[model samples]
Target: MRKLNKKLFSILSIVMLLLLAACGGGNTTTESNSNTGEDGVLSAKFGVISYLTGAGAAYGEAITNGLKLAQQDINALGEVNIELVIEDSAGKADQALNAAQKIMSDDSITAIIGPTLSTEFFAVAPEVDLNGIPILGTSTTVDGIPEIGDYVFRNAVPESLAIPAAIEKAVERTGATKVAMIYGNDDALTKGGFEVMERTAKEMGLEITTIETYQEGQSDYNAQLTKIKNTNPDLILASALYNEGAVIMDQARKMGIEIPFVGGNGFNSPQAIEIAGDAANGLIVATPYFGESSDPKIVEFNEKYEKEFGKKPDQFAAQAYDALFIYADALKRAGSSDREAFRESLAETKDLEGILGKFSFDEVGDVIMDVTVLEIKDGKFIEFE
Candidate 1:
């Protein structure tokens, strides 16, 4: 009878211990269930959507490279451990929407970092905002982005600011009076850029001799280039992705259009020169980041990036790096990775010095930063000033 009682007691104790473990015992919780841990440290999860396998893959590669470096640096601080789940948008709107939907379904993701392009943001941001998830864009710079909702934000300076600066510099450098404009008609980014350039050209007292529109993936620009060449303008203003822009530059030079080309942020990559070769030698574009800055912060980042990636970082990499740090800083300031608290803290960001420059989000969620005029000389980007 004594042995039987002891065995029963032991079984009961085991059952109670199992129940307590199942119920978490008030101190242990799964990573997906809470942002706080037993040790009271922030372990937040984030999602990144970038075009890793399409025409915009160059930009996406740079963005993710920078993100990985930032993650390493931020995690090393020991106060915060950030884990990023990356999604490839493939430069497609539907792909971006699918990626964002997958991220929103996961309850653990505190914030999302991209959709890569302005057009992708237009497609995916509204739905993400409706789900109450915050998304910060690293390279999306077209107008009306942050206005999608309070949940959407971007670090890229808009075309409204960058385009005018580049155009003004082009006009000043070449004394260009008449200009020809070429743009991709099917995409929001290129279309918006074209509109900004048109208005800016008029404001700068430059005549638009001819305006030509091409489809996004059209390889043959002979018709458009021939028309633009007939105008014999002093310079050409282009709004296009690197692929199409490079083709345009190559075709323009092959057809004997030798005037200097002034472009927007889309042309801010070494791939342009890789494709256009000598045609891209004197290309002038305005961007928020100059990889060759004398600033110590910029120098350190560039050196590290080159050593790791075997190439110099571009504006996209710099912007994505800033975006991740901004998010992590907001997480620290809030002291909680809860969505509402994090969003509030992110909104209060002011005059934060980033790799690009000093940047802060305006009330509309657009980044306010200085645009630097850069001219591509000898296959490398150099400050125009």
Candidate 2:
């Protein structure tokens, strides 16, 4: 009887030990999957939706390069490991929506960056906000973006701010009393830019000689340019993507229109200069970043980016680079990859020094940054003094 009792006790003890071990393993697994690894390093996954293979490819490429550089730097810090899952939106609103949906399906993605243009943001941001995932726009700069939801954030300065700043500087420089405007009426970015330009121009008491509109992919602007040229305006205000803006400037120049062009955010890319060639000279735009900045941070970023990408970084790249660091800071503050926690932490960001100067978010997740007016001179963007 004693031997039989001992055998029963032994089996019970073995079962209890096995159960405890299983529970311990389960706890470790959960911890590993949440925020920290067994090695005590923080980790998170980010999704990027960019217009990688379309008319906006230059913007997307710059954004990607900046993010890649930031990723490398963040990983090298030894505090966190960031894994980027990038999807090409191809500059389409529908594709952006699909990419956002696909990215949100991954429960591990803590946050998302991009959908490059504001039009795509309108499609993807609302859905992502409903899912409670933080979506940061590195390049979407239209009005009413942050109004989408609490989850939507952007480092890109809106046209409401940029256009006015550019116009103010250009007007001061040229003492312009009249302007001709051309804009892409289809895209949110360009349309928003035109509205701001018109409003600002009116408020400044500058007469608008003509207002012409075009679609996104339109190549020829002869009719509009002809009307603008006939007006004999002191300046031209263009709200278009880089490609369209370049073509318009080239055509306008060829047509003997010698007025300075005050352009929107789309003109911030170097591709504009490349496409327009001499026409790009005297082109003016407002940006949160200037590659010619003598600041140590800006200089270092320019050198490193030029070395890696074999070209200078533009405003898009600078903003995207700053965005990654912003995410990293939020992740560190949250101490976990919980989406809500990250969103809250990101909202608290203030005065973070970046290549774009001191970066912060307002009450509604809109960027609060200083703007610099720049002009294309001899195929380079120089600060408009």
Candidate 3:
């Protein structure tokens, strides 16, 4: 038993070390290519403005991996020479705006990939838009974010679509006639999902008996869940980020509430499973990509990703991968490096082949992705047929 404990300790230490290493140096590796074309023609620069450093760094790495793969393939064709200039949009609004300013100051970058989060995207949008540069959000799904700028487009499904399906899942499968809405009220992304969950649940005839909210970094969710328990709703619809989701799920399990738990897209994460332990076994959520997809394209991507990253890639990572390839497809279809033409070409995308469903951006710049209902069955994510 002592030897077993020691071995477990060693494994934990190694895992922690790996995580630290991954967190340390990220997205700092940029290609030092200094080649360029003639002055009159299109410059071969694509700006990747993303949260590639600090808190949202891992998210950026996933995106960077996808972008790098597409860039490599496109350049390998030898038909078009493209240089991806990656920039880190860290810190707050001011810092994000500064990054946009820097990207714009350099006239080389044809288009930008992301600011990652909706809040930061809003801050950077005006600057990038004023310069007539189009920004593609790889995974920022918050509703009403399209108002940030006309030049911004999203490759991920809007929160409105995914969150509603989750609500429907709860109402139909769990028989959740009365629900208590819980969410990270402080964040724009989380709040957007929460609002949709509320509206959709109401529309689907599920009574929202109570509403509970929490700010990020508040350790105890007991107070919020306490309110939820009082209402005695059939289930809780949590619009949560992965960080706080574990806490709520853990607390709910400890409270002895066997009524199933469901959450939004952000809850479809590995951390939620680790933190929720056995409680997460039955947890359900809505998402665009299923890590367990049996599709040939998904299998191919999964095999390649597992070989490179040494683990299964999450839906967030898939969004990043699909977004880059989608943009590349549009650029090739447009047949011109003209920035205006590229943006217009992106708008014309319809049912284009992609890793995450098809590329069909709606009028609001949100991708019309096929949202799937997923549940944690036996510690593994399985699609709800």
Candidate 4:
């Protein structure tokens, strides 16, 4: 009977907690305490749901740097207070969803910028959408993801824009009547690239060549590369992650397999150079927009970054900067910190000039930006144009 009594009490406590949680508005006051600004204007808070400590940390850190710089500039404008919260996703969808939900429940945030991986972005986007809070993902390229949330959007260029351009550029240049396609079969980003490449290749009347598969974290790409070479393709289209992409490029080059390689955003970073060494020279990839920047504003941004980080800005930093500025732009246009108001404001943005490209979202929530062709030549990135 004593054991039964203990069980009954445990069940009763859980029931009470659930009841309290469901009591709508009961916990809201407590939650709102942290959101009230110094001027009592209830300043809007934004959460960055990201993979701050994972294989994605490099990208995550870039996003954080951009947001921080933008926040400082926003504060300096004497505008309403903006509180920023950053939570680590650890590169998991479930964790991303939970972290985002907790942030939304606080009533402080009017928007969010995160959940790095496309899978995680989609998972949390619906929850954020249901709450009517705008979610801007910095690096999601998976197709059909943005629709997960009505308030969901991304500042980064979508796969539809970048993936096809890479294909067209490679196809046009390589004259790859037959091109072997190797991709990460399970990764949403890589898979999207694969589908787009395959579709475009078929449409262009190029031979389907052969489709090969690889899993993430595979250090040895010799078997796959050898098979691709044996097919005697005119060019190699690789849909891969940064690490794996470098490995493939390096190994392929070592084996005397030389073809003008063109890839998606996976090759936009310096990581390709680091991994492929001198082999990376002359490799081409697609990015959102490559700026022929002469604007004084851009010069200032570059100088500031160089002074602080001791490195020139890469594509990752460019997108991150644009994401934060875009968020702030929405807030300015809305003239309020309210979540719904900002969402409406963001929707009205048309052809706004951004660092990476001119950003305008299409009907399907994809950012309308042209894919930029970038080449690695002489240890520096140059627009192939």
Candidate 5:
């Protein structure tokens, strides 16, 4: 009887040890990279939705380059490893929605970086916001962007600020009394830009000679340019995307309109200079970034970007770079990748000196940064005095 009792006790002890080992294995498996890394540090996944092809590809390329540079710098710090999942929106709203949906379904991406243009943002941001995912718009500047939801934010200064400053600068520089306007009728961004330019022109007591409209992707602006030429206004205001803006500028120059062209946010791209060539010269636009800035940070970023991509960084690149760093700072401060917590930290961002300049978010999630008027001179965009 004593031998049988000892055997039962031995069997019971073996079963308990096996059970404890199973429990320990379970804990170890869960601790090893199940969303959070070892030591309770968060590993985050981020999505970048941009136009890798189609009409908006230039802007997308720049934004991607900036994001990649930021990703490299952030990873070098080794605090958190950010996995960037890229999606090509192809400059289509439907594609943007599809990309955002795919990224969101991963259940790992803590936030989204872009949908490139404001139109894409308008199409996809509301839906993503409904899903409770945070989206940072790197180049979305139109009004009603952040109004999509609490989850929406942007680093680009809106037309409300950029357009007025640009127009005011043009007016002051030329002492122009009459101006004509052209804008894309099919999109919110150009239309919004036109509205702001018109309002600011009126406020400055300048008369609008004519207001013309064009559809995006239209190669021929001769019809509009012919009408604008007839007006013979002191200046011309163009609110258009880069491709169309280039076409318009080229056609205007061919038509012999020598007056200075005051451009909106859509004209704030290096492609404008590339496409318009000599025509792009004297084109003035307002932006938050100047490639030739004397700031060491800007200089370093420019050198690195040029060395990496063989082209200087433009406003799009600068803004996207700033957006990612903003996200990183927020992620670090929140101490966790929880969406809500990180978002709160992002909202509190103030006085962040980035490549662009002093960065801060207003109550509406638009960036409050210095707007510098720039002119295309000798194949480079330089700050206009």
Candidate 6:
């Protein structure tokens, strides 16, 4: 009986050792084979940091919808398999930083998309670039974003481009001789827009009557609006996010300031019209995408997007949609899911056909695309005549 017991114990110990060894081997294989599967198909995981809840929820929702739609289309192609690990930053810089750190901790993550706003991107981009992870900004349009590092890129048209276009159109249509500017001073996006608007207004020979400032989330803009009204400038140039932009326009209308408003990119969202209602009329802004375009790509995207989301795609959604395809194209060109290879391929992207017209990235990773100046007439955006 003693001999039998000793033999049984030895067998059990050997089996346990073998099981432990197998499990260890499996972990190492998973780490090494992160970019591909057993079938030899290239696969990559991307992280998405978005402000899914907060004042900027509309922007985040649109971005999420576009990305999801693109994901479905990309995976259907069967050339590669892509996965997104989405995190909600809630429009806060600290939350955005935390999300970035968490996403970068995974060694297998090939790239990241968004933190929605430029301020959020600013808080997280430097650290992400230092970690060697490529981070793409789908909706951050503020200037100097690409200046952070080679690893950082943005598909959103910068204020330096969009604002000037809108201001020029406003000057041509309204024959404005002077302008009153109001911008959210606390946020990077609005502040950047204001700087561009100021420079462009001066260059176009328009006098700067008054420059008023407000912070984000401030409800009472009576003082600033009163000062702007007193100036009696031909046009009101506003640099603010959708929430603040809507409120400002509403308050201005209520206060009997009936002049047309030439706004920055923050005015591009449909939510602005929804929130401000009739006050949104006569608002002009520049964008790279509009749902009314007759272009084949735009038409097709609109149909499919409307079917999926039960609403017409907005500028933010369209940009995010194109951004995913841009990443997919880079992945295919790289021929591997390696981060360095993907970055090189992405930097070399040029003249890729997308919903936003001929898309390309400049040397600094800013977008090169066409801009259209549109005005809200009867609560709908139509090309400014």
TM for candidate 6 is 0.86
Q: Which candidate is the best by lDDT?
A: 2
Model 2: per-residue Cα lDDT over 1-385, one tens digit each: 9999999999999999999998887453222346876688889999999989976698899999999999998999988889898999999999999888778777788999998988888989999999999999998888899999999999988999899999999999899999999999987778888999999999999999999999988888999999999999999999998889999999999999998999998777888988999988989999898877788999999999999999988888889999999999999988889999999999999998887888889999999989999999998889899
Better of 5 and 6 by TM-score: 6
**On a 0 to 100 scale, what is the lDDT of residue 138 in model 4?**
81
Off by over 4 Å in 2: 1-32, 217-219
Q: Estimate, for each residue in 16-102, the C-alpha lDDT of model 3 and write its tens digit.
A: 999989877643444433333553322257777777778778877777777776676566666566678777877367777877877
- Which structure is stronger by TM-score: 1 or 6? 6
TM-score per model over all chains: 0.85, 0.86, 0.85, 0.85, 0.84, 0.86
> Which 10-residue span in candidate 6 carries the lowest summed lDDT?
25-34
- Which ten-residue region of model 4 has the weakest summed lDDT? 27-36
Per residue, candidate 1 scores C-alpha lDDT tens digits across 205-232 of: 8899999999978999999999999998
* Number of backbone-clashing residue pairs for each candidate, in the order shown: 0, 0, 0, 0, 0, 0
Candidate 2 lDDT score relative to the true structure: 0.90
Inter-residue clash pairs, candidate 6: none
Off by over 4 Å in 6: 1-30, 254-256
Which residue pairs in model 2 clash with each other?
none
For 21-45, candidate 6 gives per-residue lDDT tens digits of: 9888745523553777768778888
- Local error of candidate 5 at 5, Å? 75
Model 1 — which ten-residue stretch has the worst lDDT?
25-34
lDDT of 4 by residue, 306-375 (tens): 6777766666667777887777777777777788888988877778777665788777566887666877
Q: Candidate 4's error at 37, in angstroms?
A: 6.4
Instruction: Look at candidate 5 and give me any clashing residue pairs.
Output: none
